[model samples]
Target: MATKTADADLKTASVLAFERKLDPSDALFSAGRWDERDDPARWAPVPVREKSVRGTISNRLKAKDQDPAKLDAQIDKPNLQTVDVAALPADADTLKVAFTLRVLQGAGSPSACNNAAYQAKLRQTVEGYVKAHGFIELARRYAHNLANGRWLWRNRTGAEEVEVRVQHLVQGAPATTWRFDALKLSLRHFDAPGEMTETLDEVAQLIARGLSGESHVLLGVSAFVRVGAGQEVFPSQELILDRDSTKKSKTLYTVADVAGMHSQKLGNALRTIDTWHPEAATLGPIAVEPYGSVTTLGKACRQPKEKQDFYNLLDGWLLKDRVPAPEQQHFVMATLIRGGVFGDGE
Candidate 1:
């Protein structure tokens, strides 16, 4: 069977100006599955194309019912120019891809999304501080994830070689774009190869100061993607990410989802430098917020403890517990005496 040519498989999309980041606020992680995709097969076959990729302007602050991240449900069509890989010069020696991280608007601004109450004064205050401080850190982490090919889940494993250049906007103009091939040095067999790590910290620290309204900073990412036979290029793909995955284990991040692990997983990889997450700056360790332990979401809700020490120990003991609990003692003994484990009360 003829396979899709490497060039035909290369897909790309540039999210129009919006503060984008996949920090903890994204709620992308879970206890059973990993990445933004809850599907068992993380990567799916998407026809590569370029068009005006429009979406709703919202965040996951209210993941559940109140502040659902549904764009069409809340606001009208938000303009997003999505440039497909095919639109770019394909015949060139190497496919040079360029992405811009422009500071579109702040979470405090009323033009951010639909509801003003959602971006109310309190949310604005908290959102501003987060944008100014940890956005760079979050951006660095995102760059690291991208540089290392962490988002290449299944279809596009790793590229033979990749080059990346990062630049920050200054004085209403961008500085010279600096190319870095260091991400190719990323090491971790059985995992995504050619990860850009050693260079990420350096890139993260490049912009030391936090953001301010007056600051018009833009992070530009330009790289070359190869689409040769037996070669793979993992470009960004826009997909539907559902936050509610109660029916399956693949939804939660593989029962071992943690901060670093999820941070590295794919699915809508890194998009923009800033995000609408309320507290994207100071976030705590990986945890189950609405469920896994039961709270306001519902008293019966109990999400698995993927990282908590107590549950980790219990799971370990359960695996080694050859003997069943008292409730199962009668069943065990009856199985030996009778043909099957019938009744314990008898």
Candidate 2:
């Protein structure tokens, strides 16, 4: 006869298997309510990161006055271009999920035991839970979208290449929604060696929490796990440059100059409404007089510190303005080069 503890372990394992196969389409076991299935189009798969660039250099000399021995040396600069990360997009998100398990024991529990049946049961239960809950469909959608979209992978030779894969949700957005900005799933077996029942219980609890519209549970989990792993995850809002500091300047060319220049160039490149804005109308062609002179904007502006200030200013501009779409942000960046914002030897 099986011991009570053994029976409990087997039962827990069975529950875990069931949880694994639970799909979103599955009738809610707790409430016994079945919701209509959602079509794939209801959600958009996250974008993946897969952009790259390549560079090449060449040089030559010119013969002077038809003298073969007398030649003038000319150094050719290297050319840089964005390499197609083979149909990869430029941005994406990532999601992670985790599970943890522990075992329960009574006073009469066996001291020594190995349970293969329990493990198999746990796997089956978890699989069932996941499937019945529509998780498989969700994962499949992400994989399909990512594979059909774009991805960039770096080759062993250091050349960046593009791969087709779905982006993982890394951060942002509340948990519980079908579309997660980011997710983390973890599974751990605790108590007895190789005992996975507790971990599966934890997973079930998380799924239930999610189904209940409890966003904070996942957020707490993310924070706890990240801290335990010694990782730092800051909010996106913090990444934006501070508004006050970004507005001030101590150089001849103000932060406004850099921002204005960036905006102007971006406007031209993206063909942003030819109808001039009051800001652009007032500042006409702040020309690069010498076509490459660092001193065009004066000595104070040429300092490395001031150069950094220009970047900060541009960042501020990007955060505030809606003149150019986010997709065209790179065009604004190009203005830095055109304005000789980095001075010579950049």
Candidate 3:
């Protein structure tokens, strides 16, 4: 991968970057409350507010006609969980991707919280965790999402491209600005390899060090996107709707929508280090991740007319009794996630 790193000579608008906080709507970190035992390394599927992954995942259960009460409890549990592997078929694609999760909230005194000491402690702890291993599983899913065109529709709503920026706050120097591609920071999978390339490891290590809270360091992420002709994109949060049926168009929707779009543009910001609660995962070379590693999910674009049927068909396959072929299951789930639930019903 191509890479570049500069000293304090760079000056850019990233000095006022905004953090793209994590959306806890996924199978991992969805529980409303945080459990101290929950590790950033391993996570389980839990019932989320979103309809796509809500409630019990019947397709992954091993026992036929499993107890409904037990299923509900599993969804409610706030600790690490072992999924019923027997319920699902084995997958052949075992690939792992690496990403560095570092803290961007330390160089400057954190003003987000009232307790200065607590904020500093929190930043150091997070920096330590990100440097130790970073997140692999989440990185893979994010790569999967990125590769699949998950945010394309909304992103395409505006003809304009977006620019993402990272602010590097030194103790007493001007902040530096950079992009993921420039830093060679991207979600890459290596199926045919003995170890990560020396260059990639070097970049990851450098990022980890920069993210370290050794000295007063402040980090923030921001973006710039302009629309072209024949299309329009507005901010998501700018529009106020009393109900879901309010008029809708090519508007951007919410800051989350913009952040999501920026992540897509940045290439490496998929579930980046600034997420709310710690999350990440890793898979070995022999066994593919059980949930949805191999699939046609990212292969084809969803036709406008078939949006409703997309979820309907998936629900029938995964949430119901019709177990599909192993590869088919992966593709279905992958496509389901890649084609985000937003704007589908409309």
| lDDT (Cα, tens digit) per residue for candidate 2, span 77-114 | 33444221111112211111111111111111212224
- Candidate 1 lDDT, tens digit per residue, 1-346? 2323432332211111122222222112111111212243332221233345565556564546454445445666554544432221222223333445443323222223332332343243335345445345443544554454333333223444455556665765666455555345332321223343445655555532323234444665544433333222233332326635332212222122221123323323443121212222442111122112222234322223432222222222222323333312221111111111111121
- On lDDT, the stronger of 1 and 2 is 1
Order the candidates by lDDT, highest first.
Answer: 1, 3, 2
User: What's the lDDT for residue 244 in model 3?
Assistant: 58
lDDT tens per residue, model 3, 25-131 = 11011111122112434322122111122234435776843688877777775543222110001221111111122333232223244433334443443344345
Give the whole-model CA lDDT for all candidates, comma-separated. Answer: 0.34, 0.23, 0.30
Model 2 residue 212 CA deviation (Å) reads 3.5
TM-score of every candidate relative to the true structure: 0.35, 0.16, 0.27
lDDT at 50, model 1: 34
Ordered from best to worst TM-score, the candidate numbers read 1, 3, 2
RMSD to truth, every model: 24.9, 28.2, 23.9
Q: What local lDDT score does residue 154 receive in model 3, on the 0 to 100 scale?
A: 41
